[model samples]
Target: MELQQMRYVVAVAETNSFTRAAERCMVVQSALSHQIARLERELGARLFERTSRRVRLTPAGAAFLPAARQCLDAAERAAAEVAAAVGEVRGRLNVGLIPTVAAVDIPSALRDFRRAYPNVRIGLRVGASEELVEQVREGAVEVAFLGLPTTSRPHGVAAHELAHDRLVAVVAPGHPLAGETAVDLHRLSFEVFVDLPAGTAGRVQSDLAFSAAGLSRDVAFEVTNADFLARLVGQGLGIAMLPAAYVRQLSGVTTIEVTDAPARVEYVIWSRAGRTPAATAFLALLDVPAT
Candidate 1:
């Protein structure tokens, strides 16, 4: 039988008075009586015993009362939940980041986003640019702050160029280059390099920057991510060219500008396809300056 029929049965059973049940159902008593009559006819069973002073349920009505109440309650609850899920801004969002190993401004932006959208649950995952990109393309996560222009921007994936920063050299505090105002390509050609992994966005940018200076780096160590590269640099594994955000904000490393270099980097990505309102709101924080 229809859910509406079950609701009528349940409402009549609860109130045990046709007049009260009609009021509860927000319909006229005549309409309620007509529907009940149709229900009983369809079920081929008598449901109510009508009397001058009161209305009471028959044995069959009592037997069906529990099932009818459960069906009506479930229908009402499902409607409420579905509306809240889609119409309300309170939900969970998963965002991925590869903004260097230790980021300053990006973290600050997240603080602002959290305070603004308190109901929107937030989670962060750190991975290489390659992994972040893959996670987004596979719909494993809702949003990611991966490095600019992934290897490919599939049709549905749209990205924005949020901030423009540069790669700087990170050297040990006691290294000879530590005292220099800036490191030049001519000076770095022979210096040992701690590089980002071969298939990551940072690596692509680093290779291009070095190539533009007409210098082939003396590659020493290649790691999966920038955080690993930074720690290695702290141990004097080698100097590295890292995004300014990570290098300048992180301890145990010193950043020096590269002399006479005309290179720039952009943090240019957000999950465009299938973005929920919560994810979209979080991404808006990226628009404000990285303070």
Candidate 2:
């Protein structure tokens, strides 16, 4: 089927309304519906179950949607490659990062990238380091920033280490340990803790550290956001261990050096197979060496 017909089908599937899809595609409703009907006839399958009240994808449509999306993405990448060959970097750049990213100022980097490559479209996804690494591997994300414990490194991806630092203990101002200039895991173990969700890279660092020291600590609160974790500590719910640089950005918490804290390494990772022009340009901006 024609690419235009595929585009119309995708639009209709996404919006679930031919009228809205037409508006999104900048075409008339009848024209968009007619094209989809023509495509369904050619494929010998009804792509959608349309009733007076709603439109839903039929089994055939559900099966066809993924391939249609891949085709559209391929077409876009091909056009981008052509532009890049002519010294124009114009494409979509999907970047992923952890919420506690501190090695690079992401907003400032994006601002500079926009100024340098005005034609390139940029998208950002915030997630855990493990999730972001998987996204990069699957090509859903073109570039990502990650922070993993020093014991582990990014596998199956092209990675460059950005920085390394140990985590620090955070406590409320009135907490017993707040006056301490530095504390070890043994001292912190006696206190309750707030931490990132279990099994996340951020959480793993602290967990591994305590386990290695033959210690067990109670994590009373589990949060997805680091800022929220800090807030919980500030309220004296529990203490937390977070990256030193990240702690400096938050208020209402006292940071004390963790003498036996787990170390973390920040990295920028991309697909080892290849990189899109937009990704390459962005990496160049960061001075990441070519792989």
Backbone clash count for every predicted candidate, in the order shown: 0, 0
Put down candidate 2 lDDT per residue, 1-291, tens digits, no spaces: 999999999998999999999999999999998999999999999999999999999999999998998898789899999999999999899999998999999999999999999999999999999999998998889999999999899998999999998899999999999899998999999999999999999999999999999999999899998888889999999999999988889999999998888999999999987999999999999999998
Off by more than 4 A, model 2: 52-54
Quick one: best lDDT, which candidate?
A: 2
TM-score for each predicted model, relative to the true structure: 0.61, 0.94
Which parts of model 1 have CA positions greater than 4 angstroms off? 1-87, 99-104, 149-156, 260-264, 285-291
lDDT of model number 1: 0.70
What do the candidate models score in CA lDDT, each in turn?
0.70, 0.94
Error of 1 at 154 (Å): 8.0
Tens digits of lDDT, candidate 1, 43-102:
899889999888889999888787776676456545544645777555666777774634
State the TM-score for model 2: 0.94
Error of 2 at 116 (Å): 0.6
